[model samples]
Target: APRCSRDEAEISPFCSLPEHQAPRCSRDEAEISPFCSLPEHQAPSCPVCCGPIRGLATRLPSCQRSRSAVTCRLSGTLLDEDNPPLVLPSGHVYAEAAVLRLEAAHGGGAFRDPRTDDVVTMGSLRRAYFL
Candidate 1:
């Protein structure tokens, strides 16, 4: 007896019998099956074939480590997306307004980077380009 595709087996009354198991269909048979002739019978719900599924999972974009580091220490708030960030010489970045407030509170003297013990000044601050 000739084999039928899973799609054809699902719809054909001869192949649906519990006593008569249908054989797997070849690529050529799959293309010419009676079930493949119609568009509505092509869905996965029709029947699951005994073969590996193609492109089962989709790929996603990689995560950005820098974006997760855009939190301010002084204000405890996230950096503004529109504003450029202030990068300290000690390699720490913070919101511009927060750094300015800290400098003002300390009377324009050297302030410590919370992440590191290194002393930094307003002159040591520069604009950072974070993507």
Candidate 2:
């Protein structure tokens, strides 16, 4: 069966049993969407890319890693969609190829989300934001 929309799921929590057990909410007996259950402090998380969660994890995967920081590339258009076109801290203009190269250069690591200060890939971006 097709899953309902997020708003509908919010309104009609009892209507379906998630394939995974229903997530307990910290607020409102009126069940919260599993997707929205993460504590507010742990934001900018990309669940799709980051995969299964454990407990109230409050930091991004990037924050947990102890590696030298990688450069993130962005175009004016992508930046416009996500944020204002302020000059990059790195002062670089990233075309699509540059993004591709970034992925390659990072040894196929995920893209770091500038907005959220998290790491996410293109596939994860589509799932978490678009869907």
Candidate 3:
């Protein structure tokens, strides 16, 4: 039978061997961690968070579908080339200076009218922008 006891081996693996094992200290003790330690956590933010932002927020000369994959109007001319109207996909229409934010179902993005500076429904401005 081996002379070394389990308790002694548990305390020190090197006890049976000629070389001494590294020390094991409590949290209070300052000791270097293992060479290959796992990280605590990863970055929570994802690139897809702004997926809708890039799709709808950008200034599109014509109408296009948003990241949510919804066809909507981004901008349009209200009174011919001289005046323009801004509309969003939500169905709300504004003349000037109105702000509209797309919901999660829509695209989870924000749209502001350059002409009226307002938020308008996406459907309303499609023809003017696309055509």
Which candidate wins on lDDT?
1
lDDT of candidate 3 at residue 3, scale 0 to 100: 34
With candidate 3 superimposed using the best TM-score fit, by how many Å does residue 131's alpha carbon deviate from the native?
Answer: 9.6
State the lDDT of candidate 1 residue by residue for 1-131, as single tens digits: 63434544544555555544634433443223465335433334222321232121111111233324455645656676654589999777778878777777677766767667677888878888756
Assess the local accuracy of residue 89 in candidate 3 as a C-alpha lDDT between 0 and 100: 57
Model 2, TM vs. native: 0.22
Q: Each model's TM-score? A: 0.40, 0.22, 0.16
lDDT of 2: 0.39
What is the lDDT for 31 in model 1? 28
| Per-residue C-alpha lDDT of model 3 across residues 1-131, encoded as one tens digit per residue | 64334544544454476434434323344332342122221111322123443333222122222322112223321323333334445443333322333333345354545435564444445423323
Off by over 4 Å in 2: 1-73, 77-95, 127-131
lDDT score, residue 85, model 3? 36
Q: For all the candidates, what are their Cα RMSDs to the real structure? A: 20.3, 16.0, 23.0
Better of 2 and 3 by TM-score: 2
The global C-alpha lDDT for each of the candidates, from Candidate 1 onward, is: 0.55, 0.39, 0.35
Give the poorly placed runs of model 3, Cα more than 4 Å off.
1-110, 129-131
- TM-score-sorted candidate list, best first: 1, 2, 3
Higher-ranked by TM-score: 1 or 3: 1
